[model samples]
Target: MKKIEAYIRHEAFEPIRLELLELGFPSLTISEVKGSGRQKGITERYRGAELTNWLRPKVKLECVVASGDVQTVVDAILKHARTGSIGDGKVFVLPVEEAYRIRTGESGEETLQAHPGVAQAAS
Candidate 1:
């Protein structure tokens, strides 16, 4: 099993999530985050005041999936998240030793299948 973590632009979160659903990945966790990359933040105007060095808001998505699904999941994120613009975001794949479902006392693949949008996470 593995964990796919994607950090994406805040505005792109909804679209990305929808795309992921369409790709057969419904289980996901989203978090509101703030950071900067090459763009190093942006400029904005609010109440006639110009904002600089702003920490742009971003969305972090976490999901655990089978090894085979890793590429598919990553593709979904990159295909939808890419805008050829700065601060589009990044994706990281990490090793997940185990998983379990608390509700039914299921372990491994069953645990992942119990998640929101998934069939299984593989053994």
Candidate 2:
């Protein structure tokens, strides 16, 4: 198993999410975040004052998937998140030692599967 963490432009979330769903990855976590990268931040005028916000808003998308499906998930994120610009964000894949489904006490890859009878694409 692997955990995929993607930091993406805020505007890119919906499209990436829809694509993931279409690819049969319906379970994931999302969070609004702020950070600085090569793009730095932005300057804005508020009340006629120049404000330099050093942390730009971003969306963090996380999901755990079967090791074999890592590339597929990463590709989907890349396809939808790229804008040919800086601050396009980054994706990281890391090893997952274990996972457990609290409701059923299920562990390992089976815990990553869709609930009971829901159809899921083969990994």
Candidate 3:
């Protein structure tokens, strides 16, 4: 199994989620996070005073997916989240050693499938 982590602009979350659902991958975990990338931070002007916003508000998406579904899922996120601008965010895919559903006692891929992000993986 694979784990997909994507850091995206907060404003893009809804579109991204709905796109994923439309693609037949309906489950995901979303968390509000603060982070900065190569841009390091951003400059802001408040009441004529300039300040640095070191950590930008972002939405983190975590999806546990079958290995075969990794690329498709990543593509969905990238496509839906892109704004052709800075802070578009990043996506990471990792090998998940194991997964277990606490309530149902399901294990491995079954556990991942149960996650909201994979309601109906593309065959």
Return the number of clashes found in candidate 3. 4
lDDT at residue 80 of model 2 (Cα atoms): 90
Instruction: Quantify how close model 2 is to the true structure by its C-alpha RMSD in Å.
Output: 3.1
The alpha-carbon lDDT assigned to residue 91 of candidate 1 equals 99
Q: Candidate 2: lDDT over CA atoms?
A: 0.90
Decide which is better by TM-score, 2 or 3: 2
Please report, as a residue range, the 10-residue window in candidate 1 with the lowest summed lDDT: 114-123
| lDDT tens digits by residue: candidate 3, 8-86 | 9887788778777776667689899998777587798999999998898889999888999999998888887898888
TM-score of 1: 0.81
Q: Mind giving the per-residue lDDT tens digits that candidate 1 earns over 4-94?
A: 9998987777777787776667789999988877768567899999989767788999999988789988988898889998888899999
Q: Distance (Å) between predicted and true CA of 84, model 3?
A: 2.2
Once fitted onto the true fold, the runs of candidate 1 whose alpha carbons sit more than 4 angstroms away are 43-51, 114-123
Residue 6's C-alpha lDDT in candidate 3?
Answer: 95
Residue-level error in angstroms, candidate 2, position 123: 20
Task: Write the candidate numbers in order of decreasing TM-score.
Answer: 2, 3, 1
Q: Which window of ten consecutive residues has the lowest lDDT sum in model 2?
A: 114-123
**Per-prediction CA RMSD (Å):** 4.6, 3.1, 3.8
- Candidate with more favorable, higher lDDT: 1 or 3: 3
